[model samples]
Target chain A: MEISDTELMLLGLVAEMPRHGYELEQVIVHRAMREWTAIGFSSIYFLLGKLQKRGLIRAYTSRASNRTKAQIPGADSQISDQESEPNTKPRKVFTVSKKGMRILKNQALRSLREISAHYSSLTRGLLQWPFLSREEALAALQDRLEALRSEEDRLSGLQLDQQPLPDYENAMYDFALSQIESEYEWVKRTAEYMETKPWN
Target chain B: MEISDTELMLLGLVAEMPRHGYELEQVIVHRAMREWTAIGFSSIYFLLGKLQKRGLIRAYTSRASNRTKAQIPGADSQISDQESEPNTKPRKVFTVSKKGMRILKNQALRSLREISAHYSSLTRGLLQWPFLSREEALAALQDRLEALRSEEDRLSGLQLDQQPLPDYENAMYDFALSQIESEYEWVKRTAEYMETKPWN
Candidate 1:
């Protein structure tokens, strides 16, 4: 089964430990996973429900009225599922099944091995160079250079704020920063080259 | 006005010169534009019609029966309308309007100036490294290395096939190839680092 990036992250988190929807949101925020994946706070429950429907995960809630709620030893006490109001919904804790774990492993490996193309809009703009005058083109590239610098600063700030990261997380941050820096250098060089070349 | 990458490309192409749907498809294929922008051949007419409706472009057909058909002097002879059958539809030749030209210029500049985030799924996989075993991780990276090499070969081959390109097109191609090469180097270094370090 092809899982989305958000699904993979959520499934991996659950595989790490049984977690409720709120707990998953905390882990995502704590790790700044939003920088890499699109996981809206509102969509967490929706995604969990989808995963449960797929049999990749099983949910256990501490409500006797809910038919799908599975009974676990001391589950009601552990979760502190206080149904203070009649309208209060049952909070379910999700755990990955064996099938989910197998799929996660396979998908992770497939993701690593694949070389998906990253298309940039700038390439399209460059292809349509005739649309913009030479002055406009140079100014746009200059503006891009400034934006790249600000982006570098912003990313660095984010990394600093999320300090004492795991070795793997640190490596990911480094890779991202390296990519932006590389692009910055490319734009600078391209701008200089464009300045010297005659407009076609 | 927000325009998609494909729309921008198509609009810019029209601004360069009035072209029929079939001609636009040919230009896209001959230039290998599908690698950068998602412009399917079937969507050309749909998008053109949308642009016309939005008043960013106007279409001229050489049919007298068609009310929307415009009369460009000698357009029938120029386009060879050839409406022998009662069911035959007149081929539309789309041209960018003055307003279209202004918007296209602004959009092209904005596209150049903006630095949109390019999220990679590999980053997500790397973040969830805890799910994969050490051997599995190394093997995946190795497979990725091989894939990157093949990708490099393929991109190089494509560039070679489209020889004697314009300077701007050459620059765009170089930027793309450079990005892949940089990623390959990063992956190689990362794999080596992972080899020596203890897996978490």
Candidate 2:
């Protein structure tokens, strides 16, 4: 079964542990997962719903969570008789089913093993280089270098904030940095060429 | 005006010269543009229609093309009296209008100057590394290395085929190859770490 990258990412998170939508959002934010995945807060609930429909994940209110809730003053008063129905509840914690775990493992393995090309608008712009005047093209390339530097700084700041990262997380950050540096080098070289080379 | 990368690419091509749908497809294929953009043959006409509605491109039957068609035996007999109606013609060539050129230039410059994050599923899989056993993870990394090698070969071959490429086109290919190589290095390092590091 083909699953979208976003779906697989959500499944992997749920497989790690039972988490409420808010907790999922927190984890995503704390880890800066947005750098690598285009997931929004609203999509977390939507994806969770989809995962539940697919039998990949199921929602449940753990006894511990319920007990903690009960400890809060007047919490018991707000509890509905149909406590089993988690769909209507505002804070439904989700756990991956056995099927969900299986799918997650399969999808993760497939993703790790496969390589796919990403389309960048930079390529489109580069291919149409002749369309822009020399001055405009040079200015654009200079701006790109500045943007890349800002990106590098942002990524470095994120990496520093998450200290004591697991080896894998550290490696991920390094990988991202390396990509930026590579692009930066290419842009610098291209800019020099654009400056010195004759234009039509 | 904001245009999709695909729209900008098509507009750039039309700006290069008046071309029919088939000719655009040929140019795309010949230049291996698919590596940089996700455009399908069917979407060419769909996008063309959209560009026309936006007044960025206008279709015309150039006299040169029509004259060539008239040179064919029996072609004049097939010509309708309402020759001005290009919509009914099989080969209506599209050219970028003044507005289209202006918009294309602005969009291309913006694209060149901007940097945006692209979400990769591999990051998701890496973050959830604990989900897989050592054996499975190691095997997946091995497969990734192999996949990267194959991609490198394919890109190298494509680069070779497009000899005498413009400086910009050559740089684009180099940028792509550098990204792959960077990832290849990261994957190799990651795989080694995964192999040697103690697992929880």
Kindly list the per-residue Cα lDDT of model 2 for residues B1-200, writing each as its tens digit.
Answer: 79998898999999999898988999999888888888989999999999999999999764565555455676543554246346445567899999999999999999899976765556767866878898998899899889889988999899999998888888888888888888888889878877887984
**DockQ for candidate 2, C-alpha atoms:** 0.66
Error of 1 at B20 (Å): 2.4
Q: In candidate 1 chain A, what residue range of length 10 has the lowest lDDT sum? A: A78-87
What is the C-alpha lDDT profile of model 1 across B1-200, one tens digit per residue?
77778788889889989888888999899888988887778998888888888889999974444433334455564243455343246767889999888888888888889987777767877877888899999899999989888988988989889998888888888888888888888989999999999878
Give the TM-score of chain A, superposed on the true chain A, for all candidates in the order listed. 0.83, 0.85
Model 1 lDDT per residue over A1-200, tens place: 98888898899999998888888999999878888887899999999988889989999984544433324455574343354334246768899999999988988888888877788867877877887899999999999989889988988888999898888888888888888888888889999998998887
What's the i-RMS of each model?
1.1, 1.4
- Give the Cα error of residue B40 in candidate 2, in Å: 2.5
Every candidate's DockQ is 0.64, 0.66
Per-chain TM-score of chain B, candidate 1? Answer: 0.84
